[model samples]
Target: MLKGGCRLNGKKRCLLPLLLAGVLFSCTVTFSAAKKIPTILVCPKTLDNSFWGNVRAGAMTAGKEYGASVIWKGPTVETDIAGQLAIMEDFVNKRVDAIALAATDVKALYAPVKKALNAKIPVVSFDSGLDPDPTLCLIATDNYKGAFEAGEALARLIGQKGKIACIPLISGASTSILREKGFNAAIARYPGIRLVAVQYSESDVAKGMAVAENILTANPDLDGIFAANEPGAMGAAQAVKARGLSGKVKLVAFDASPMEIEMLQNGTIQALIVQNPYNMGYLAVKTCIEALNGKKVPKRIDTGVAVVTMDNFYEPKIQQLLYPAGNSGK
Candidate 1:
């Protein structure tokens, strides 16, 4: 009986070893088959502007929702094309799953974007798009439409036919170029309205203010002004105010900075064409994730636009998207 008992104990020990081996093999297979979440790199023009901050928030939201890591990095200034290119290259070298960029120079970014594509890393352009490569998906506002609306608003404010000057941040940047084209096209509809001058400020607030000052001095009869972005608009408004012509000259600007919104409320500025920057950031990341999953995303996604004035500026929907709880002035 004792011998028989020892044999049964030995058999139980053998079975235990088999069970442990089976469990270890199953765990290894499970880990190997687990899905790997892709990492997304977001390279904005700059983080100093509130507009880009909204974009970063949007990208973060998408990153959280999709279980992906997001790296938001960019130059402190807008004109840092070389800095932007370096960031793109870094992402490519790290073998990031994807990159979303707001190109400082559309033509200058072609080589870098192409290199990313060659490495099988997908590239998406947000805010400012690349013109060279047809494969890059672009997520941005319909700048022309938004700028046209702004021009119409300015024309209405001016009432009589007069000369309007435009101070754009950058001459050749895709967004500014589109805005200039749209503004010119719309202003052309009104026979009395004329674009007197177009100046490039290099996206510098101080330079924009100085340029506006010079233009105002050169053409005191300038009845209206359009700024392609928030900083440009604010700087131009300051120049107009310094000359004691705030309400006298109609100002139509882009981007709804807190100061800009306040100006709109106080009647300092007539109108603002606000871009859905948050949506642009969010959609850029979402599209990238979709692409990674082999899902088709549209090459050009218009994140949409809004025209804000004192009347409906405080609307709940716009406030929730633009100002959110902690970010709002009030």
Candidate 2:
């Protein structure tokens, strides 16, 4: 027996064959309709750091778990707003199932993100966010609270009285703006502490080092420093160490990269304000997939942060937070 033909629709087909009397039989048996595996595009601020690397890992892990094809792409530097915008727009035109973006600039990315929304593509903004957010959901750390905690930690290390300077990531980024404000707000609490100089690193390590060196030179008696991101932190640490002011000028930095961790162990960086980048990346893709599946998704998801210091660095939970493998999609 044989069927005339098989109709291929939005379903999967399995063929069962039978042979008898030198005759062959074929039948198209359909299982429940197969769902299309979605292709999700994940764009972080930059493709050049361990933070974004962790995010990529988390996103890929989610894609594997949820039957999605994940495409990771971003600009080479975090300051390349135009580059990131072009990338997003290209993906939108390609009609990828969904887009997970960690915008380079808060306002600059709104147009393309809005365009994606208009095209019926779900957008999930993570890390740095979009202003007038048109995305389906935002997954990020509480940058303000983390920076405030960093300020408080620096204040305590300097014994609540000293000249301190700040090196924020960049001026236009939401993360930069919030962290700078939060640190300033915390510093305002104590009349004895004076925030002497503030500079923008533009998320460049050499620039961060140069900025810190200038600040230290201007205020020879500078007591402490707060660096708001990884590049800034690394640069500040190098500056502090080069001047042989390792433990003298207390430094509290954000994100614990390998260099920062080495600095922490050697008394170059006093504390690290760490975010769950892995969790952030994982949740972003998970949310995008959910939206594509016609499932309800939350408007906001806080991946949270931790203030890490020598006193609690070895704790199991903190260790897991610092290492990506210990806490992927958990």
Q: Pick the candidate with the highest lDDT.
A: 2
For each candidate in turn, the TM-score is 0.91, 0.89
Question: Candidate 2's error at 209, in angstroms?
Answer: 0.5
lDDT of 1 at 248: 90
Which tens-of-lDDT digit does each residue in 1-330 have in candidate 2? 125454455122323322332242222222223547799999988988688888999999999999899999999999898999899989999999999999888899999999999999999999988777878888999899999999999999999998999999988899999999899999999999999999989999999999999999999999999999999999999999999999999999999887888899899999999999989989999999899989999988889999999999888888888876764211
Clashing pairs in 2: none
- Tell me the tens digit of each residue's lDDT in model 1 across 1-330: 244344555777557777999999999999988868789999998888789888999999999999899999998888888898898888899999999988888798889889989999988989888777544688999999998898898888889489999988786689888888888888989999888888877777788788899899989899999998988988888898888898998899999878888888777788888888888888999999998888988888998888877667677766765574346644
C-alpha lDDT score of every prediction, in listed order: 0.85, 0.90
Best by TM-score: 1
Model 2, residue 48: distance off in Å is 0.9
